[model samples]
Target: MPAQEDSSTRVLEDLDAAAVDYATRIAGASGPARAALRDELTRICLPFAGRMARRYRGRGENLEDLEQVARLGLVKAIDRYDPERGSFTAYAVITISGEIKRHFRDRTWGVHVPRRVQDLSLEVGHASMVLTTELSRTPTPAEIAARLNVSLPAVLEALESAAGYSPSSLNAPAGGDGAAEFGDLLGGTDSDLEMVDDKLTVAGLLLRLPARERRMLAMRFYGNRTQAEIATELGISQMHVSRLLSRSLAWLREAMLNDTLPRWEGANGPTDPHGMQIAVQSGGGVVTVQVRGEVDRDTAERLRTVVRHAVSSLAGRGLVIDLAAVPLVDAAGVAVLLDAASAAAVAEAELTLTGAQPYVARILGVSGLQSLMR
Candidate 1:
């Protein structure tokens, strides 16, 4: 025991000497020498930062981020450390721990909390640690309140706020075998499936429409072809095309609201086709395609087909695709748009996109398609 104590004393003395040397150099040196001394000091104290950071592990924040925070705190402590006032290690531990606590208080709260409550939460935590150490047991809220000279209710509130400091991930492992995630145990309806149901209902309703009306609707909405173009293509007068479009849209709206359409006859049911409604309108040498519903791999082919048909028929006129009603667009859908744009460019026609949802717009921006959007 005497030999061990001697060895421990020597190690501490060496650390103290190093700290003093670093401090003296840091204070007296200038320029490159000062930077070198700071680097040396940081290297010497890195282990202390790591030790302090380890105390904050398993608290939701990444270990690497916490270590970085602790290192920052160590640097601050070293710059401000007064050897005449205290031991360097003790000062560093306090500063590093404070930094970790501050990180939790400022950033880790999943919800907004009052500043008073946030500060109190930290105080309560410190009190609990002190009480736990002294009593050799986990401290109750009442014990912590007494130790901190705070009311029991305040302590309880602080304790509650502490839970917000580290919200667990829903994807975290839950079951013993780790086969299930915490999200699997949570209860909530899948909203995307609900959207799929609505789309399927719409598809069923579309199937009820006549083939001519379906083709006209597709040309007007998806091909961005005007009533004149649709009429010319269908061998009908412009007035008749307008009347047909109005009637078809009204029927679709009523069918969607009242569920008046019969079920789809497809073997795979309503959502099997997983297609979107595209209406094209052409007038004054411009074609507009209005796209509705999700645009993913399954629906992208239909989009490509309609756009290609419209671009071919437009004779170099501009094309505008309105996507206000499109809730989602995947990579395949984006690819289809890019390919259509390329085709239109090759045909010496201008293509403009409008009414993209924020998410779709972000995707377009990221994919370098923002230049094509109007």
Candidate 2:
């Protein structure tokens, strides 16, 4: 027994002496030779590192990963170890253990956790285990806090943070039959969210219309009344109600798109000259208004007058506006067209706009008067 103990002591002394020589030589050596010597020493120390690694096994980390961490710590110890400070074995043991613990503290958590809370979590876990063994049951937060000499809140916080260490997968089955997942319990998209902007814009535009038009719109839409019902309530003909509702809604649509309200024509609104000319003809009870120039804010009133007169004497016949020579139409022109269409509806006559240029056609389409296009 004495010889065997002496033999073990000699082996330990030889290892310590060899470690000192390697450290001394590495400090003085440079280039590939120094690297070769460091590698040789690392190879010798690997068994010791692996032993240190095994102590931390079964603690929720792979044994191989912990061994790699320990070996990394071993290399750091060799690079930093000094002969005068202490024994190589003792220094290496501390470094390797610290590296393994740091791997758990920093890398094992599935989510970001404060370092203080992480350390407290370990303590709380240990205290729970001790109390569970002693009391033959899981310990409460207060009991665990008392065992760890901490506040109950801290213990509870640590317990909560423990879940972040290895979070359950969102795709994991939440039902016993595996038909549903955890993510299925989450809320879906709000379909009405897409219409929020449109609804708001329409609301503001509705306020800009006259009270009579607004009431007609509310009765026809909000109150779910037919054109005849709204006309009866307002003591107007169904055709008149149709005209007002059409005009109001079309104006709102144009306002929403342009982000500006177009001027509504009164019986005597001022007119300007944009080199515009209008010619009206009647034959077989079908009146036609031919326009020749750009129809804009400056000339919208002139066109409105000719179309209104044609509709007034229609006597249940159709009125056609020839836009073949018209070059362009603006928001004001679109408003006039909507008003013309409304007037024709009230007169029980169909109003059609024909031969509009591509640009003018697009303007009418966007103004919600595509139904008026021939």
Candidate 3:
């Protein structure tokens, strides 16, 4: 029995001599004669290739397919073999083993994985198997890492990525009774979860507002009352209630975004001590309106009125608003500029604004007026 096993496993000396002779002959001849020589050499080496392929039989691949891969590797070795380099047996063994391992590494993954991670996963898996046999139990990641001289995190990552090798389908049954699928375990996006930060921030901001503004906001929103009803309850005009609500809401939005509170104007008007002034000059088919001082809610209407007169009085020419002296402009001021641009458009006149301060220019840019700037 021992002699028979040895005879079955042993490679013949004539096979090596034939391979070297065939490789030399095939390199110089490319016709049907060269192909016949290569085919004959391959038939002689079939038993040797089958032995290499059998080493990987139980590794989740069919034996016949592995043998085919090994045979293909043998053909490549024959084509590439140089007679003076080394023995054909050693070269063919390396090539055939490499081809089989390459097939397993590249083709069997159910999910895409990095080559490094896949290699590490195989190392970790082998280590776990060896340690399990020695320890007589399933080895932990730490044990595998210690045995392989790798970091614990690396072992853990390898084990986690190994799941990608054979990922279970989302539609697959999750339990013994098959009542639920794996997809049933996933949770959906919660709509209110995204608003948690906003709600917390608004709650903190509402506590910082004045008593009257806070009370009015609660009455209008939480209590669901009209502005006129709020005005009557607070003993103020409905217009005043509307202005206060707009101002408070604007301040809250600014505070939430910028982390700075906007200055709240007095009941009479904006707190800007320097009142706005508008001076218009006409020359050379151009009307230039020179503006001075800060433009806010209270002063925006005056600027709007002056710009309107300039637009209506144009005689087939252009209008230029010089803002060199203007220091600051609010949202209301920007609205007036947009209104002027629209009226000029309707009159078939071109309007250009020039010489705004850096801060005021940024405000205009944020207000979508950058195209009109000169």
- In the range 153-229, model 2's lDDT, one tens digit per residue, is 98889999999999988899999999999989888999999999999888877776656667878888889999989
Tens digits of per-residue lDDT, candidate 3, 1-374, equal: 99987765465556678877887778788699988998899999998999999977665678999999999999999889898988888899999988987887788788888888888887777677679899999998888888989899988888888889887899999899999999998888899999999999998887766556789899999999999999878766686678678877987898789866665432222333336668999999999999976566657889999999999999888999999987667777888999999999999999898998897899899898999999
**Candidate closer to the true structure by lDDT (higher is better), 1 or 3:** 3
For this target, which candidate reaches the highest TM-score against the unseen true structure? Answer: 3
The global Cα lDDT (0 to 1) of model 2 is 0.81
The whole-model lDDT of each prediction reads 0.80, 0.81, 0.83
Q: Please give the lDDT score at residue 303 for candidate 1.
A: 92
Alpha-carbon runs more than 4 Å astray in model 1: 1-12, 122-139, 147-149, 167-374
Listed per model in order, the count of residue pairs whose N, CA or C atoms clash below 3 Å is: 16, 0, 0
Per-residue lDDT tens digits for candidate 1, residues 1-374, read 99999986776676577888887777777889988887888888788788789886765679999999999999998788888977887788789888888887787788779888988887777677778889999998888888888899999998988877767899999988999999999988778987897788877777776566688889999899999998777665686577567867877877777835543211122343455788999997899998976576557889999999989987868998888877667767888999989989988999998998887898888987899886
lDDT of 1 at 209: 69
Pairs of residues at least 3 apart in sequence or in different chains that clash in candidate 3: none
* TM-scores, each model vs. reference: 0.39, 0.44, 0.48
Error of 1 at 282 (Å): 88
Stretches of candidate 2 off by over 4 Å are: 1-18, 27-33, 126-149, 188-374
